[model samples]
Target chain A: MQRKKSRYIVSYSILLILICVFVLLSICIGSVTISWKEILNCVWGIEKERTYADIIFQIRLPRAVAACLLGGALALAGYLLQTFFHNPIAGPFVLGISSGAKLLVALTMVAFLERGVKLGSIGLIVAAFIGSMLCMGFVLLLSKVVTGMSMLIVSGVMISYICSAVTEFVVTFADDSNIVNLHHWSQGSFSGTTWSNVVCIGVVVGITFFYVFTLAKPLGAFQMGEVYAKNAGVNIKRFRVLLVLLSSLLSACVTAFAGPISFVGIAVPHLIKQLFQTAKPIVMIPACFLGGGVFCLFCDLLARTLFAPTELSVSTITAVFGAPIVIIIMIQGRKK
Target chain B: MEKKEYYFHAKGLKVGYKKKPLIENIEIPLKKGEILTLLGPNGAGKTTIIKSIIQQLEPLGGVMYLDGEDMFAMNRKTLAKRMSAVLTNPIDTEFMTVEDVVGTGRYPYTGKFGILEKEDKRVLKESMELVHIVDIAQKQFSEISDGQRQRVLLARALCQEPDLLILDEPTSYLDIRYKMEFLSVLQELSRQKQVTVILSLHELELAARVSDHIICVNQEGVKGFGTPEEIFSEGFISTLYGIKVGNYDEKSGDLELEAKKGKPEIFILAGNGTGSALFRKMQRKRIPFAVGVLWENDLDYPVAKALASEIITVPAFCRISEKKIEQAKQCMKRCGRVVTTLDLSILQDYGSTLRELYDFALQNQLVEEK
Candidate 1:
């Protein structure tokens, strides 16, 4: 027990340190390199040059915080999903929940933009939430029809394909004036985030994360499986509903803000589990949130600066790092 | 041990899926510290009945009382405090240690964060110790053997510190020794702690040996409910299972395969437990055989009765009469060969009368050398 506690302490400390380093790196290594000393001076309104302060306050800070919050939200959503289905591969992106949200958000954006109206952050989140619930409902129904985990994952991949195809169709044949704006968002990036968007993402993800944290006890019981969870006095029906709702809401929040980042949801929680050597929800839930932030911050940094003149979308970078972890989980699952 | 008031009473319980009752009117009267076993073949609604008692499924048409309180009326947490179950559902977990799994049984006792208190930790230690799983507490739950996993689950259930315990085929995947050890832990728990145990068992011999009360369950409902002696009555298990090809010994709770048929190919002079091995060998070889002039009270009587094609027997404590001896001669003469579990060198030691039959077989060259 003492060793386990020490491991938890060490893992959490490492994640915290990594998050700090990544956040600082994200801020420091942009198109124009700025040292931490200059960044601090800019924050304190002591910088003589206004361009550095303007860039720090206007663009980089909001983007960094958004990546941290949305990434944590995505990972927490994945953890809830894996627990719900009792499958390690279950996640927002893999289950096509993010695609579902992306599809609707695209449709909503096109409809609103065609009318020459602007859609707010709240409107997008509400649309995303509805879309996530719809996809979640389909997945739940599919789970009933096909009891095998691989079958469910296969059907989820199919759903993802169908949703993404429709989304591509909407983006491809849309009005020429809207294409430029729609194309970048469709590819999924942490760029173009504003202070207002950051506040919205923070509030939504914050409240949902607190709720997920309070569910740690029941979620721990649930890890043992449905029957044992019920025997442990957890109201399985209600608990399952709560899990679905919280997970859907969380993934919806991430999709609303960041436009469907891939694989961080599945990869971060798995990495956290390995680091802690335990899947107890009490530790996994908070640790997943922090580990996810660190992962996305690092990935977003790479997406921004890996090629200085041309930037890659966050999903492209995340998939490169995250897909192999998922494959490893599948292989280990087969061995078991 | 003799409490006048019943601890758990399930009166007219109807259990099944989705409001369709598969088995109805299951009345199990159990006292504190007593073990009630549900026995039946597969798909016999034994699991259904147990699930109802644990309130996993609502009773379709009846009320169950635990310690004189209506069970269904109690809320989930309250019910969980009083009762715990180890189900047959395969527990698929990832990255969880045995201690992590066992500590979850304190769900009802823990506070909001579900952190184990000092008392809860002590209970966890004691429960692991009771099941002899302390050595594997730090091992991954998935890495352990199935027997160890079962015991860990049992320890998890024990950590609930329940007054009433329920298990569904708890010994199904266990080996012989693990099954014995698991059942003995249960027996000790019941005897020492006065915990009321209700479990379903597929092994009739284990059930007979461990259960204080046995309820025979089938699709038709409770077939027979009584002490082990009453339920395992003569030929009752055969009737219960619809055994068409074997014999069930009520006294020893042993099952025997169907006997070979037709006329005798071999005859043997055997008695006092020596002939049973030869009788089983003949049964396995599918050869019909006969034995001669043995007393009914011999140690080999049960197996001989189960497998032999024909036997000439004398009543216990009776002197070998000439009629029986003549009957033995008739049996031995029909077979082309004869074998003896007894030594022919001690032919006079067995009885002077039996020397005539062996001498007859020897003169005809019918006896096979051992």
Candidate 2:
């Protein structure tokens, strides 16, 4: 028991160190490098305007915080999906939630470009939210009709395909400028994150995180099997629906603000599982948050630094890292 | 007969999938301090009935009462307090210890958080002791043997201190010894604690021997529900399985087989509690069988008595006597075929009765020695 507690403490400390590093990296390594002292002074309102410190404080600080929050939210969403479906491969992307947001963004851009209306980031975020909500609503409804996890996954995949087709159709008819916007949105990036968007994502994720924490025992019961969970006094139907809603809301918020950043959602939870050797949500939730923030911050760093001045899409960096981890897990799981 | 005060009462209960009823309009009463075994063929809705009673599946029609209170009116927590269940599916938890798994039985009383008090731990320890799994208390649940796992699951249910404990085919995956041991444990638990047990069992003999009440379910729908003797005598077993039970063997206390023509001479070499099954099958086929040099206190002795077969026995020890040898020779003289079981004692004495039987078969050409 002492050994187990020490191991838990070690893991928690490592996550804490990673979180600290990511926060420092987020604040310190932007376009115009500001000294740590200047950044601190600017944050504390001791620095004047019209300086690099002001840009660092006003723009990059909120953007970095948004990255951390969105990363945590997406990772938590993925953790819930993986447990709820009892499928290791399940994620926000697999469930068509990301595709739903992408489809909505494409539609909004196409319609606005046709009417000579220049759509803002807020307009796109709203459209993404509506799209994600619609997809979540459809999946929730299908979950009622389907009892098996595999069947629900198949239904989600089919929905994703349909959404992708619609997005493709919009892309084909959209003007050049609108097509560029849609392309950038589909390949998720954190370039447009602001203070308002960060606060919105933070609030939504905070509420859902608290709700999921309360549901930790039920989720642990689920690992035993659904029948056992029911026997243990869990109202399976009600708890499952609530879980899905919270997960979908978390996924929708992140996708809305960050344009559906990948890998962090799909890979962080799984990495946490390997490190912790458990599927309990109580452990997985905090692990997912820290792991996601670190992963996303690292990927963001790579996306910014790999091409120097030219920015690469965060999705590309995440895909390169996440796909291999997922493959390795699948292969190892199959061998077992 | 006086009606027993039942702890769990199912009244005209109709359970099924979708809209169609699987086991329809069946009324059964499970009294406290009773072991009720549900015997049925596949797709007979025995599991369906158990699931419904446990509220895992909702009954399509009719109501169930638990201790005179409406079953549906009780919340899951209250219902859990009244009843606990052991399912056939293996629990896939990796992190929980045997103690942790069994302690979850206090979930209903502990509320959703599963906080354990001194009384709860005492109950958990006692339940573990009852199942004889206290030695492996700190072991991970996944690392236990199958028999040990089954017992641990029982321990979990027992920790609930529930009035009714439902089990679905608890002995389906167990070996013969574990099967008997598990049933005996259930029987003892019910007798000592006044806990009502309702388990579906496929082992006919074990179920018949241990259960106080038997409910035979089939396509005919709740074919019979009464005392074991009452249900067995009603021909419910034959109807439920669509197989004939010719006669009851008073000695072995098992159903005997009717005689058939063209019987073979079978010399069973089983002893030291073995060959009961071979004896039963040989009786079923009406093959004339004899035992050689069986000890006085062996499982086959009772079987031989039940079948009314000729037997040779030594009072004690491994030494074969002249009188027993003569009895065996006399039986061999009248028999057409000679069969020997692969028993350890018979194998040890390769040059004795086995070789003697081989030589007799060779000379008489009655059968080729196997």
Candidate 3:
């Protein structure tokens, strides 16, 4: 057992190495493949005023960082929801929380565009947060009424559909010239990321991540479910509220920045657990952050490069990989 | 020796779901190093009272004191340090080994990060060993069988090093051997560690053997609470569970469903204790039987008293009375068949008056059930 657990050290190190390689790969290999020498020069401020420097600093760097942060946030959000619901496949997307945020963010965008007002990064995240919470509240209420895990997941799928339909309705009839932009954002790409947006995502998701880390102990207790968690001294009501808010904040951040990116939230944490061979939150929380970052960075690269000038949606790339894992998980769960 | 002071006490407790009380005016008390068993049928508010006392369900009205402190006034961590419970909640410890599962019992004592110290590890190891699950400690919880899983959970609760342990239907998934082993381990904990164990058990025989106190709960309330001796009197268990079809023999802790409620079809010459199983077999065969002349102190009395359609009796010391013999012969004539394990020749050689009754059965086509 000790020998097996030592593998966790190896897994963590491997995940860290993967994160580094993927971050660099995302930053260095964009449409115009800037040479390493030019990339080094731009980062080191040797050619600060050059176009190479502008592309590296203003565009790829912030976008890559946002993908890393928001992706980690999404996976951690999934982990929290999985723990909270005691369901392995429960995720922000699966529970329709991200779609909820998408619906509200789209509403906010349309409402602002009608008055010729632009929503800021903070404004978008706040709008998405409210939407995620609203959807989360509805799912929780459904959970109270439903007895089975399948029923809960089905209700969540229905919620995702309802939110997606409303977002489509808002997008189609909007008279703004930026309706094209609304359509693109709804497809969930990591493009249009700014340094300011990166900062907001960093502060919010970063703080929420740390808060989640603090909850690792109770979260571990929670794996045994509510009865044992209470016996283990967890203040369940307060802990439950914190769980909902933290998970909402994370998926809300992802939806605000990149639209409702799919599969990374549910799949990444599961992949990490398999890699580590243990679900101890002390290890899984950080592992999910790093794993989610690498996963999204890889998917985002595939999204941008696969169709070249006609970039595919990031979620389309993630769904291609993530949806299969979800299917496998369901099959395995049924077998169990 | 520990004095018999109450270690836990609950008074006037009202418990239910959604504040709609299912049971009311409950009171129970326990002493250190004693085992208490709760007995009730399904959905009799047994679990409700357990959950309520553990603070999982809010009591509509009550005050509970643990170790002389007002329980509701205590802090969660403090209460946790003193008490632990093994409930029926399903565990989803993904990839968690039994050791890792048991290590969770250290949560209340560990730092905010839930890192186990040497002491916590010591407690965890001792708990695993106590439950005889040390060999399986390295195995994943999901990989173990249901019985093993239950043992792991008990080990987890024991790892808390609590003064009081609560369990609900703890032995439900266990096989008979594991059931006895689990109860003995709890008994050892109670004796050696002075731990108080309060649990619900479905087996009345087992409950009678182990409990220092027994509580019977129903939808109405706590129907009865006392020593096992007090609780086992007369139709207490039957009335408490509202059993209509069966009879629960308090003395022997045997339950017998209403015997074929008609005239006797078979005459059973039950002697000594040889006919208890045959009595049950007759009952199962729907053959109402009249058993002859079993003394009150006889081993077969309890069972025969439960299932026999008619019993011919006489004072045990005196030889079977002529009047009782006549009565037995009359009842035997009514039976479609008379079966006896007794040999007429043996009874004649022993000069027992039962020979007369046996000879009377012989005239009526007596057949011995092997």
Candidate 4:
């Protein structure tokens, strides 16, 4: 017991140190270089004049914070969906929750541009939430008809494909500038994040995290399989629905604020499992939070630094890093 | 040791899907340290009753009590701590080790964080030892054989350290030997640990041999629930399966068919791990039969020992000796017909003996020439 506790503490501390380093790196390496001293001074409000420190503080800090929050939220959502559905491949994008949000955003943009109207971020967030909830509603309905996880995953993938087709049809008829913005948004980036959006994502992720944590015991019971979980005292229907709602909420929040960031939601939870050697959510949940934040921070750094002034999509970088890690882990598992 | 008493009591229990009861208004008392085998053919609602007792499927009409406490009111963790279960389907977990899989039984006691305490580890170790899978503790669960996997599942349930253990068709996929071994282990566990074990098994003979109490669920509701002798003798099983039970021999504890007259005296030329199931089938069908030329140490010796027949046998490993072959020919002469099990593993060099028997049968016109 003592050894286990010590190991946990050591892991938590190492993760904490890694998060700190990533945060510092996020603040340091951007389009404009700022010294560590200046970054600290700006954060502490010691500087009295408008300068590069102001730009870093105002623009990059909020973007980085938003990335961390969105990454953690998306990963947690993926973790919950995977456990609830008992499928390793179930995720926000695979299940069409993110695509649902994308469709809503795309429709809202086309409607606004067509009517010559300008909508605020809050309106977009609401549209995204409604879209995700509708998708969740459909998935939950299908879950009743479908008894198996693999079939449910296939159903979700089908829903995503349908949603993507609809979004493409909408984009072809929209204004060129609006289509460009929609295309860039669909690719997913942290460039549009501000303080208010960060706060909204943080609040939603915090609330959903607490709710999901309360479900840890039932989720662990679920890991044993559904019949055993039901015998073990879980009201399987209620717990499953609760998990779906929580996961959908988290996915919607991230997609609403940061657009549809792909691999982070699908791959971060699996990466955390590889790192921790266990899927017990108590460990994996927090590990996913830290690991996801670090991953997104690093990806964002690469997105900014790789081609200098030419910014790459953050999702592209994440997929490049995450796909190989998943394949390698899968190969190793197969070898064993 | 204190004599622990546990009684699973149901009052006016009704269970089914969609709130319309499949089996309703039923009550049964299951006692501790006893093996109660739920005996039924398919679609008899045995699974429903088991589910209701464990509170997996909600009781549509009534209440169940475990040790006088209301089962429905108990929290999931509390219920899990008291009752561990093994369902029919194998859980598909990709990466868990055998020990890790079994250790999950401690989830109820380990709190939400699921950190294993020293006591939890001790329980896990003891359970693995009890199930005799300690050697495979470090191996991945997917690497084991089906029988080994079943034992590992039993170990996992044992690790839960519950007062009552429930299993649904625990022997469905096992061969006969493993089936017997699995039931024997359950019997031992019930006796040694003072735990109440309730399982659904299709094998009536094995259930008769192992269970302390038999609950026979037929289409006509709960047919019977009592000791094996009381339940088996009540003709409930015969009615349940719609088969005759006259072959169920009481004295020898072996089933023997009442012989039919004017039929061929079919002497079974089988031995060495063959003829047991065929013997039972023939006996159940009331077909007259005999056996010969079996070695003393062959696997079929036990079945022959149980059957009321004349057997010619030589010393162990004395294959096809002269005296035994003569005895076989004499037995074939006395009988009007013959049947032989084609054991490819054995009797490959017995072609001459087979040809001799065939020629004799053809010469006497005892059987049509083939």
DockQ (CA atoms), all models:
0.75, 0.35, 0.80, 0.31
TM-score of chain A of 4: 0.90
Model 3 ranges with Cα > 4 A deviation: A41-49, A110-117, A172-176, B1-5, B261-265, B329-338, B342-351, B355-369
Best by DockQ: 3
Error of 4 at B139 (Å): 4.3
| Candidate numbers sorted by DockQ from highest down | 3, 1, 2, 4
- The whole-model lDDT of each prediction reads 0.89, 0.76, 0.88, 0.76
1 or 3, greater by lDDT = 1
Among incorrect, acceptable, medium and high, the docking class of model 3 is high
Model 2 local distance difference test score: 0.76
Backbone collisions counted per model? 0, 0, 0, 0
Instruction: State each candidate's chain A TM-score.
Output: 0.98, 0.87, 0.97, 0.90
Alpha-carbon error at B7 in model 1, in Å?
1.7
Residue B337, candidate 1: alpha-carbon lDDT = 89
Q: What TM-score is obtained for chain B in each of the predicted models?
A: 0.94, 0.70, 0.93, 0.69
lDDT tens digits by residue: candidate 3, B1-370 = 1233689888788888996989888888888889999999899987888898789998999788888888888999999899999888777778888999999988889998999989998999999999999999988899999999999999989988899999999999999999999999999999999999999999998999889999998767788899999999988888888888968899988878788857888888877777888999988889888998766767788888889989976665556667877888888888857887655565543237676777777776765555
- Output the lDDT of residue A237, model 3: 94
Candidate 2 lDDT tens digits, A1-336:
577668767887898898778777767776667678877787787877567665675676776787777788888888888777776767887788888988887787788889999776567657776887798888878888997656777888899899989888889787876777667766788776667777777777788888888887778767767887677677788988887778777777777666767656778988887677655566777878878878887787778768867889888899999989878867865664
For model 4, how does the per-residue alpha-carbon lDDT over A1-336 read when each residue is reduced to its tens digit? 365457667777877787778878888887788888877777788876567666786788888888887888888888888887776767887788888988898899789888999767678777888888888888879988997756887788788888888988998888988888777777788886778777777777888888887887777768878887776566788987798788888888888777787767668888677655567667778778777787788888888889988888887898898767556645764674
Q: In lDDT terms, which candidate is top?
A: 1
Specify the poorest-scoring 10-residue window by lDDT in model 2 chain B.
B342-351
Let me know the TM-score candidate 3 reaches against the reference structure.
0.93
